[model samples]
Target: MAPQVDITVFPGNIVNNEFAATTTTRHAINPSTGEALPEVPVSTKDDVDVAVAHARTAFKTWSKVPFAERARLLLAFANAIEENREQLERLLVLEQGKPLGLAKMEFDMGIQWLRTFATMEVKDEVLDDNEDRIITQTFPPLGVCCGIVPWNWPVLLGLGKIGPALITGNTIIIKPSPFTPYCDLKLGEIGMKIFPEGVLQVLSGGDDLGPMLTEHPGIDKISFTGSSDTGKLVMQSCSKTLKRVTLELGGNDPAIICEDADFSVTVPKVATMAFLNSGQICMLVKRVYVHESIYDKFRDAIVEFTKTVVKTGDGFEDGVLVGPLQNSMQYEKVKDMYADIKHQGYKMALEGHAMTNSKGFFITPSIIDNPPEDSRIVVEEPFGPVIPLLKWSDEDDVIERANSLKMGLGASVWSKDLDRADRMARELSAGSVWINSHFDVAPNVPFGGHKWSGIGSEWGMTGLKGYCNSRSIWKWKKVM
Candidate 1:
């Protein structure tokens, strides 16, 4: 059953395994119906301090717990989430505006991710093994980890940080985006049963929360997922503390549609990635470079496929594939971009449509045809259900064009030729490149960005190390 719009309210910082409500609060709205959902407390700087202090105190013991015990508890927590998946997923949908199916996927993926991290282990290395001296490396926990989660897929992204942080023996304070704080905060609440007090915490708040987490002395590391502009600010802020930072920022990812591509299979697959979550995903295929010979065919196939599969409505409604955007700030941004497209007379493959006088921030799928290379729709990320298809004649030229963008989070190349696709994938500049796929992330693989997209990574052996500092221990025996 769908949860009530006015479901139970949530408190502020979860410090020491208890909810602490603050004086200030922020109201979360349901984008599908424009109704205000539960109001979550706004954690102030003081609240952040409390959470950080508790995390620091917890680290003393958490970092000392046997790895087997920590992994067992984390796996137990993941199982618990699976048991409570339905209710948690409903909570995510009410706040995040993703369709009920997508929200449930987020919860399910989050649980799998937690288990993956729980099972992940890295072996210590012997730097040197000689008769006279022995030196080895060990992974020791960083004091405290602060995760700043974005709104689009908060459940999956939030747990991305939590799993790695906890498994690596660091206590974490999760600061969920005020736009969609409910599910993440609830995760913190759920974690209390499995984790020790102060091991897991969440601070929901307004503008002040981010700066507090980045600038504070207590936070040892930070993992952020958001816009490139905001990521720069986070990097700048973390510089003062010299804390380890991992940022998964914005992307203008391009997908190369090779001449021999299978349109029947490719069109629907690309359509799903291009417009999934209304194209709010960081790795969505924002640009398409179709071979000139097959450009028209590919474009028409996509348009036809979109017409058949695309349906925008309230998240809970049956047969609704797309839902209203999660917030107004993003809605206005995309709305303005569409205005510019119309003013410039760009040839749109399928014109956009909006809700009729409804307060919902709903926008139908938009496919702009062959916008100029320099146009805003082509250059900047609109982060909406809007995509631009361009023509590419030569693989070399298309490769250059695709790698031209500054954001290199992810990219895809579609082709039946395995050799060609494999070679192209190697040359792509993005951190993750897929052949015949886009935005296909798993818990075991390391996910991150290159260039302006991000620094460092998450969700692998590397990610586990992100939450820890490597220590080299040495022993020298006297000549016996």
Candidate 2:
């Protein structure tokens, strides 16, 4: 059963700012319990239009603010996020079902990014400085951006887009995933109080709202993080207006364990990487390329490790290893993938399934072993935590197999030899490569993908670039 969200008369910005389209508030549920949460307004297309209009209007004044002042405001926003971390963290856990600790970590990770981008300064450079002529360049914000954030790490991705966009002086309308909207709506309410009305706005509701915002002519850019299929839809919607777009799409990231690698160490880590968040992350190790020599040992260790780590329950419980799948569709997809691979004669070391009579959609930790290289389980990005092991003979062969996918968001190499690991890291096609490590990310570094993983980088200085357009200035000492 879906949880009910209460919509009552609030009679203020939460209502009026909803663009006066609908008065009814919708319930956000705990995916784990199917229980109603404090309701947030479900926005209408009119609300989306109003949010974009407000952002466009705000851009006029916001774009003129000195870079330093803009940075200061972002810093203030970051501080506020840090101060309210506890409240925000709980809200995220309630809606998203990420373990409480992991939820808190995700929140802080985004805060780190906000702080980093806020303090970062764009240094001016003279393009040409010959005695006869000189030229320069400056990076400036695109007027109004529509940020489409995924539900996986809501706050982290939301902050990733909002922090850079605002610090660079672009007013933005954020469209939170309908699966989880309360946190973003709450974020908007607080953000509006901190910044001006038009500086930042949040749109919460059904799928139609995303298309409306992305396709709106007033939007100058679209920053989206979600599945590749949906990313295509977003790009198509933005095509008519030719809005600048940056997409961080799906990934079927591979982890390579060379012959010399220790199965004892790598297996346990791989299980965590594969199953964490119940396998919802784009960069989760969906495919494993292991040498034949240690295959059995590696497989057994991973099964054991998975059994130890996964404890099914609500996300708030301490020592809980796994939580409910974000929604039923995702839950069904994971099961379908499991069945598809099973039909291909792959042996399952572990299989995922939802608990009976449960409020939230759930799946057990699963390990699908040695499916045909061409099987959907191996070829498609199973955003669920089921890992398919593919054995390879050499480094070149492993690299070839890993890069065979249409996606290339992230990958990692696990080997004891530093030289070999680094060599393989250089060969893997990914935006970020982890050597003997799976999921560590930093706000100060750049992350995105090659091929179809994504269109532009996010985080660090590169992330800021996605929100801006470069303007070249030429001062000819002698005019032609």
Candidate 3:
């Protein structure tokens, strides 16, 4: 039996280990039902000031705490999250509109990230050790950090920033997207019990809240995950104060199906990547370039696989493989793209189901049958359950087309020939390239974008170093 979790009972903004309610509030909509779940506090400039001030105060002591103790506490925090795993998973489904199983997976990924970050340490490097002189390079934490999380994969992405920021001895304030803020607020509520006052906080609000926090002088750094256009805005805002910024933005990642690829195995995987998270993930494969010889077979197989396996409706429904778009803005955007595809008269191999009768913001999972290279569906990211299957004969032309897009977060190659796949993967312009797999990320591996997709990396030593400032120490044995 499933747990009877009531998502409405969650708290609001958390500052200094306490709930900070606001006079103005907004309701978080349940994308599955097209109804409001519960009221989340709409933070104002004063709320931002309070949270930042608390974070600033906490950083003073947090930065001085020993690394071992910080790691221990972080482990304890991860344990606490495990204790409330079921509740968090249920809440995630209600607010984020992902299947309950996917919600659980998100928690699992988040918990692993926290645990891995706890074990990671940025050690000092000895550049020169000699009789006459010794020089070393060390990483020191940057002060108060603000993490702005997106609607999709809120918990996983939220923890992605939180784990590294706190483990590196920096105090952080998280601002979750208003569309799906419940889990983040609940996380903040849970954190208060384990962490010291102001060590970790979450503030929920509408659009204005982001600029309030990003432009504030108190915030030393901004770690943002959102669209490329919005990421550009964030960069501009941070430049006013010259705040350190890490932006993980959009992606139109491509998946190349080589001639040697097995359609039986590759089709299912490519379809899954294209439609996962309702096609909302930044790193999801948005375009597919199939070798001309196998293009027709791969397209037919994928269409059949999607029809047989992909189920959509409310996320809580059993065996639901996809869910509604998390908010109205995105739902409308995807609908517009669908209309455009129709207006262009592109052949749709598989148009799963009509959303007209559905109550929630649902769109039919669709596939374009080898559309024109410059078609809207092929050129722009639909960010919904729609994908373009393009035919490619020349390897160089396909590679060029794949890398032509401005956004390059991730890409994948499907080929049984390991050497061929490796050579092709190396040529693709992306932060993470896979031979046979997609969306394979780990805490120890660095992940980021190569172009407009994002700036700076997340996870691993490189990501961990992003939270700190490098310092070099030079000492002389004798007055040199």
Candidate 4:
């Protein structure tokens, strides 16, 4: 028999601050070991109605609570999450299959973000003031928000929606990815005790659940993180109800290495950035363009570093630099991509094949050397641990190639020459361009995409606004 695991987090969905059981439920599998972990409730269309109706009712009262008190409760929830860090971290690693360090960091980041929003003050702006008249701008909450969290970073992504939505007075219902729903459901369990009934909710199920929530007339908005294809569908679903939508979608990000970059500093940093989370991050460096003058040196340096840096295994084990792929759907996708690369006779910097021994979804971190620019691995997002290194001599040529995709999520420019890197970063067709660094996000900074990656923004004042509607207030005194 498989070793027993905890299942206390479920039995039913929480509605009106209490457990409401659904007859059906589903079990989660440990991505690293392929073992059944726990059975969680599979909520349904009726559950969506109950959740949204409760949220709509709660929003009436929640919107009236003092902003400062709301912030206090949010911070208190953050504290609660930290206090339960050990349990949350274990589930995160079990379902998500990221290393412990990464799992811990993601949870920590979520806590930190809640606190950041706690301090943020979105005060009413006084547009004009005089004896005869006064004008002010206020942002009122959007009611009944549904945050659809992706599997890759469920804790962080789920909290990314929770913190802002609640702090800004919008009640939230989170739909976590089926493959990684444990932590999110647990977070909902935590929220139930701390927040007023219906203020925060989590519903865990497969494909059909999303459409039900999105199409519900009671839902006011949706904040989603997933593939560009699904994002388009989310937009279509919400369109019928005219619900507001904020989407953070796919990325085929690029990293430009100018001739001036330091090989020692650049190689290892880029290697980590490229393969972190097994290259599942939407912002992870996908396509790399190196100046021909330093291309060979850069490629060799990266290969040496990759050998020393990566060791795939279970997240709980010691000395494991990377963990297994999060689920079988993504596992098969990466498997097919790797097979194609082999069949096409691409050169692998790290000689290996897809992993099979551990009963887990695992793949070796791979880098292709000088593949044709038109290759599938070069053009499509493998969304796994494979990347391509291409050479370019002309600045104009490389920039054009990088911007060729319909997606413009993120890009990076690396050079010891500050001016050249800045110029290159400016021209790169991406929403967030980093000069030397990659994937660093702050709560106070606005982050999103340009073309196909996202709609609207998250974080900063703009992020807070995304959850609200701007209402202009006017007061005038009669002159007698």
Q: Which candidate comes out best when scored by TM-score?
A: 3
Whole-structure CA lDDT of model 3: 0.90
Q: What would the per-residue lDDT of candidate 1 be over residues 153-228, giving only the tens digit for each residue?
A: 9999999999999988899999999889888888887787779989999888887789989999999999999999
Q: Which segments of model 1 are wrong by more than 4 Å?
A: 1-7, 477-480
What is the alpha-carbon lDDT for the whole of candidate 4? 0.87
Q: Give the lDDT of residue 451 in candidate 2.
A: 84
Runs in model 2 with CA error above 4 Å?
1-21, 478-480
Better of 3 and 4 by lDDT: 3
Error of 2 at 393 (Å): 1.5
Per-residue lDDT of candidate 4, residues 1-480 (tens digit):
111223345666667777677788888789888998777878888888888889999999998899999999998888888878887898898888999989999998999999999988778999999988899999999989999999999998899899899988989999999898888887887778789988998888888999999999999999999999999999999999899999999999999999988887788788888888888899889988999998888888898888887777789987676688888988899888888889999988776456767899988888899899889888888888888999999899999999999788999999999988898888988878998888888888888898899998888889889999989998887655
The TM-scores, one per candidate, come to: 0.97, 0.93, 0.98, 0.96
For 192-296, candidate 3 gives per-residue lDDT tens digits of 888899999999999999999889999999999999999999999999999999999999999999999987778888888888889989888899999999888
How much is the lDDT of residue 266 in candidate 3? 87
Clash count for candidate 3 is 0
The best-first sequence of candidates by lDDT reads 3, 1, 4, 2
Model 2 gets an lDDT of: 0.80
Please report, as a residue range, the 10-residue window in candidate 1 with the lowest summed lDDT.
Answer: 1-10
Better of 1 and 2 by TM-score: 1
Which 10 successive residues of model 4 have the least lDDT summed? Answer: 1-10
Candidate 3 Cα RMSD after full superposition onto the native fold (Å)? 2.0
